[model samples]
Target: MTVIDLVAQADGADPLETEPLYHAIDPDLLDSLPDADGFSRLEFSYQGYTVSVTDGTDGVEISLAETGVSVDGSSGDLIDTEFST
Candidate 1:
């Protein structure tokens, strides 16, 4: 999923090598949220990042919260988390 992809990207590793997204949130619930009438956003922590998914008229936007540590155990900084699909 996007969270795993982003985390893997930040770590400079293959997405498959990253932790499973389901470990941080319910994948099935997340997949079904767009169909929920009033659903707009969801946030959860994966690895060392806080993942935020916002639903809008344009599309779903994914972002990561700034943290003090990264997946590689270094200082964390915000990456390009503002993307829609």
Candidate 2:
């Protein structure tokens, strides 16, 4: 999937005022396949906040470095944490 796709998935969790800067693995490597089937990390710059998402076999983790907060979820509500800059 493209970076935009990751961002879209994340954004769908909640409506936020922060703008997102999306980045993803290059989508042009037709001959190449990732070692993993899911996303490893998704990061974006919203307003001044840097948000990141990491997925593991067991679950997904979301973090906001600027707020020094993080959330981990396997399935359920979207975890929201606010870091203190």
Candidate 3:
């Protein structure tokens, strides 16, 4: 799952360079995410990208790890809620 998540946004050639999931999220949260609902928004950073998994967003959202940068690199916060997952 971690590799899938990393590769989903990684530069492909360097996806393996991303940090392991264990270093990105807590084990407890990671363990419970598979059962998480869309009502919940869980986010974290892997390597230099942001990873977001919302209850109903279908899948995770990954982007460059920059402040005030939206998924499209617009001038707004990509995520409104703090990291809770």
Best by lDDT: 1
TM-score between candidate 2 and the true structure: 0.34
Error of 3 at 35 (Å): 2.6
Q: What is the C-alpha lDDT profile of model 2 across 8-42, one tens digit per residue? A: 44445433432333322233431133344755766
Clashing pairs in 2: 67-83, 67-84, 68-83
lDDT of 1 by residue, 1-85 (tens): 8677777776688999888877788898877877887788888878877778888777677777556566688886555444234
Top TM-score model? 1
Task: After superposing candidate 3 on the true structure, give the runs of residues whose Cα lies further than 4 Å from its correct spot.
Answer: 2-5, 14-17, 36-39, 57-85
Q: Which candidate order results from sorting by lDDT in descending order? A: 1, 3, 2
Which residue pairs show collisions in model 3?
A: 37-55, 38-55, 38-56
**Candidate 2: lDDT over CA atoms?**
0.41
In candidate 1, which residue pairs clash? Answer: none
Least lDDT summed over 10 consecutive residues: which range in candidate 2?
22-31
CA lDDT, every model vs. true structure: 0.74, 0.41, 0.52
Instruction: Residues 1-85, candidate 3: write the lDDT tens digits.
Output: 5534444444455555555667767756755765766446666765445666655455443333334553455676443332321
Model 2 stretches astray by more than 4 angstroms:
1-36, 67-85
Where's the lowest-lDDT run of ten residues in candidate 3?
76-85
Candidate 1 vs candidate 3, TM-score winner: 1
**Under the 3 Å rule for N, CA and C atoms, how many clashes does model 1 have?**
0
Residue 33 Cα positional deviation in candidate 1, in Å, after optimal superposition: 1.5
Q: Residue 83, candidate 1: how far off, in angstroms?
A: 5.8
